[model samples]
Target: MTRSGTDRRLSDDEMASWLPLIRLVQLLPQALDRTLREEGGINHAHYAILVTLAQDAEAPPTLGEIARIAGLSRSRLSHALDALARRGWVERTSCSTDKRTGSAVLTEAGRDMVRRAAPAHVAQIRALVLERLSDDERETLTHLLGKLLPGIESAV
Candidate 1:
């Protein structure tokens, strides 16, 4: 059987589960951005870029790879990299095998900055997010969200 029109709306149970999650999805990034800007002098975008690069600092990944990991478009990542480069925190080099391709390498300064920011950033996350849930709830949340990621990624 097929339902139509008003019958298509979310059920009460579904709404109860979704509303808070929707709000958190909308607002958490802003809160984290505010904290990061105040404490680290960087916004979440820059922080994400730096963190991704630092993960493979010895062999920097290509811009496309970084873009995919950071969930940013190439143009947006390029702009952020430009700003970081001006701050002397990251350097971009043309790929040795393909001059048209580029990769971002974290500078010593960038590595140090991420290291300095990590502890406080993690603390902020704990205070705002993790501390709100019990250990079992946290585990369940991770498991539930992980189940959704593949579908979400494919939809995009």
Candidate 2:
């Protein structure tokens, strides 16, 4: 069922409500990617993969799991893993439980890289985003985002 032309257009309040989120979705990833590529010699996607492995209970995670968590396709994740492996940031080992599955392990070097990258990343985040918000605004933003996250995850 299609709406009439007037109804199809976004309402002013709807535009106002969603514009910031749309801008954020467009800009944040590009900014973060640029920063990580410049300072860490890795893109944001690669950083996410490493961080996911680092956060794993085993300090490593199966390739499929990492791909899912990172929201990347298997081929893209495989290519990123290959690059990380060449940099000595990650090591791939055949899973003991499932020979066909491979796991990516974060190396000491990778942990050190993440540590080095953290300060600059946090500074950039603070300067560009967090510093602009008041305490109450920050809390509200967090709460609102938290509320929205489950719905987004369910869609995915």
Candidate 3:
């Protein structure tokens, strides 16, 4: 079938192709959330925030920066940080350069928590996602995803 113009709507095959990706995106987060919540008393987003702080070169990042990196709103991030702080998993410190700005640091306990949670998280990811792909498919998917990333970043 041909459209009147060059711009065409998605074909059935194209739509079908996206179904797996869409389902994966939806289910993976839920699965991860369930696993983390059960095992670590933290949701996937919380785990991600802690891991991001742990991986940061400074071992801490400004709340604003953390919110940006975490793709969460400042208010939402603040709430999450508050929860984490209450759980004793993270510490907020006044920035040396800017007293008004605060940084969130993963505590020793947080580090240990993340370290413990990591293996199960990695295993789950591998089992659900990576292990399903053949080596060639993995390489191709990585390359294609890398190529698409710049455009996504630019759009954002």
Candidate 4:
């Protein structure tokens, strides 16, 4: 391909590695959302919030913390919190010590939702990804992705 001097295009070998990663990044979320919505009436992001809250059941994390962990902006997290609250799956409350600080608590129904939805989600992940890879392939992919994550996180 022709390029101007300033254009530093990827080499063929780089494209070979990047193309599949790009496609997987683009497609996997849509596929997960479809299955999650079909199975539980919530998209993957909402499910992720539920799972994260479950992980910190003893002390609910603040909205900012949840947003950071979930890679969502504060505004996006607020919107999601509103929806989850409406569905009776979550309750958002201001911290007693600092009224300006807000945290999310998963309801009993939220736990129930996670319980009912986890099986289907796990199955879809397995079918679409894990089952397709050998043990060694899975390990290598995990290592490579882990190496990439710091840069990705920093960019965000």
Candidate 5:
């Protein structure tokens, strides 16, 4: 049998590393989304936005900054913020530093939602991931993924 020039295949070691990560990446978000929606009445993306806003108590970052930190595109963040705003969880306002820019601020209701969701969300995460790992394994995984993120993010 002849192989095509473009038909590079995954080696066993690569598959061993990548296959599980691929499955986790694909399914974990859905699981988290479901849990957050059921327990907190919000999906994961909206939850992420709320968390981003909660990071700074005194002032909010601009939309672009939130996009960078949350790993969301501008449009996605905007839409999520819109949903949150409609729910009285988030409010977008003109940035004080840059009037042309906008920032998202978490409302009291939003902070309460995050507080309510955190315990369940954390439990779900532990059930799905952390419980399966030894502490050392978890630390190693975090180190490895931190090293991997820059390359992956740059490609996007």
Candidate 6:
């Protein structure tokens, strides 16, 4: 009853469902990135890093924790931090108690930038995604994606 790899292929029904999801996955990031760049001179990844830091602004978390929360690899996080640091929007610092551990601190400028950029980002998201779906459809989509998240997370 097992199908060989060579024999495996998506059925028309499966392709019908998958094609839009594939397109959405690829196009959504580009769309969001365009908005982010225009509104704040930052891309989605940089915005994610800033927002992650801002979440714990009062007591910045370690780089490792930030990496996990921001869904970025450590090296990518380091590179993003370098850009943010150079822009004076973030500062990388050692933990006072743990010399070997480091944290990304969101600067006042970063906070201000998020404040200014968030509204536009939200509006764009609404325009591109949320408003397009009915409430029930949105809820169903959220539920379906949540089911897929575990497998996707594990792959990463």
In model 1, how large is the Cα lDDT of residue 2?
A: 42
Encode model 2's per-residue lDDT on 1-156: one tens digit a residue.
443677867777778868988999889989988898788988888988888878849435788889987778899999999999999999988888888988888999999999888788888889888999999999999999899988986786
- Tell me how candidate 3 scores on lDDT: 0.86
List the global CA lDDT of all models: 0.87, 0.86, 0.86, 0.90, 0.88, 0.89
Instruction: Please provide TM-scores, in order, for all candidate models, with all chains considered together.
Output: 0.85, 0.80, 0.82, 0.88, 0.89, 0.86
Ranked by lDDT, the better of candidates 1 and 4 is 4
Worst 10 residues of 6 by lDDT: 1-10
Show the lowest summed lDDT stretch of 10 residues, model 2: 1-10
Worst 10-residue lDDT window for candidate 4 reads 1-10
Candidate 6 to truth, TM: 0.86
Model 6 lDDT per residue over 18-122, tens place: 999999999998998999999999998899888888884556788988887667899999999999999998998999889999987889999998998899899
Candidate 5: segments with Cα more than 4 A from true spot: 1-7
| Model 3 lDDT-worst window of ten | 1-10
Candidate 1: segments with Cα more than 4 A from true spot = 1-7, 56-58
The C-alpha stretches of model 6 lying farther than 4 A from their native spots are: 1-7, 56-59, 96-98
In the range 1-156, model 5's lDDT, one tens digit per residue, is 444568689667767878998998989999999999899888887888888888856778889878877678999888878989999999889988789999978899999999999999999999999999999999999999899998998897
lDDT of 3 by residue, 1-156 (tens): 653556567678767878887897799899999999888988988898998889858435788878867767788998999999998999888888889998788889999999989989999999988999999999999998899878865675
lDDT of 4 by residue, 81-123 (tens): 8999999999998876789999888999999999999999999
Kindly indicate the candidate among 1 and 2 with the higher lDDT.
1
- After best superposition, candidate 2 residue 58: deviation in angstroms? 4.0
- Which ten residues in a row are the worst by lDDT in model 5? 1-10
Q: What is the lDDT of residue 88 in candidate 3?
A: 91
